[model samples]
Target: MTRILVVGATGLVGREIVRKALRDDRITRLIAPTRRPLEPHPKLHNPLVDFDRLPEDAGWWAVNSVICVLGTTRAKAGSDQAFRKVDYDYPLAVARLAHRHGAMRFALNSSLGAAAAPRLLYSRTKGEIEAAITAVGFSSLTIVRPGLIGGDRNEFRAGEWIAARVLGALGPLLPRRFRISPAPKIADALVEAAIAGASGVHLIEADQLAAD
Candidate 1:
């Protein structure tokens, strides 16, 4: 029986991850900590929490695996530091707590251009969080780096919508790596990696995300 923790249960990719995990017979239990409440389920332990102060001693952190889909856009966050707090700080906090509580597997939904020294703050922050989580010592760490995530987001961005539409139209013509990655497919990969509990660090790049 695999017990799982999902940190960003309310976001685009996170929401899909939660729904899929619920229907997955391999997952015996699921813990989702978010600012808002989720729909009630028999297998779910949904806790309303402030990202700044997660409950370290909570029993829900003691799961077989963890999948973090937490992220925020700079425009929505309203500042660079605020964006880092959501994307980097929140996920790292969850990773450390889950690792301390004996969660052996960890999976992250990262961006395509994540790097330690990227010119873009967004990419750099994502890279930094990936490094931070790796330091937490999970037995199995899976990092799924996808291109611009294509989905129906609750929070609308005019620029993102236009880009997605263009990419959707040109998807077949573009190379696999350049094509947009669907949210549901990314969620499936994250869930499977967590449940599989494969040893060592594994990276699923933007191109691999297009494959089964």
Candidate 2:
């Protein structure tokens, strides 16, 4: 009966993770703190929260593991600062809080080309958050870097939609690493890593994501 926390549980991949976590026998408790309320579930403890004013001493922070699918696009965020707040600041804050509350395992849904130093703002933010979370001292850290995640998003992403079409047409012609990564597959990886609580640091790359 493992207790787990899932941030960004409202998004595409996050929603999938939440659904799977709730159904999973391994997880006994699922804490999802979101801007809006999530559908009630017996195993789930949904907390309405404001990211800018996260309650530092909340009891819900106590969990065995945490999976962060918290991320946003520059366009959607409207500004570079806003984008950074979501992609970098919020996840790291959750990691620190969860780690302080004794969460040993942490799983992050990151992008394919994340790097410490990158030309793109999106990749750079992802890399920075990855580094930030690593410093939080979680015993088990899993970073799942997925590429071109395929799913029916509530909001339309022109670039992702276009890319998905192109990649879908390319199909097996492209390398496994470059292929479309289904949202559920990525969700499964995050859930597995969180529940398994594997030791040390692990990076599940796009190619590996395509495998199972």
62-159: candidate 1 lDDT, tens digit per residue: 99999999999999999999999999999998998888899999999988888935889998998998889998999999999998888888887998
Error of 1 at 173 (Å): 0.8
Model 1 has how many clashing residue pairs? 0
Question: How well does candidate 1 score on lDDT at residue 150?
Answer: 83
Top candidate when judged by TM-score against the true structure: 2
Worst 10 residues of 1 by lDDT: 203-212
Candidate 1 segments whose C-alpha is farther than 4 A from its true place: none
Best by lDDT: 2
- Which lDDT values do the candidates have, in the order given? 0.90, 0.92
Q: What is the C-alpha local distance difference test score of candidate 1? A: 0.90
Candidate RMSDs in Å, in order, are: 1.4, 1.2
Q: Clashing residue pairs, candidate 2?
A: none
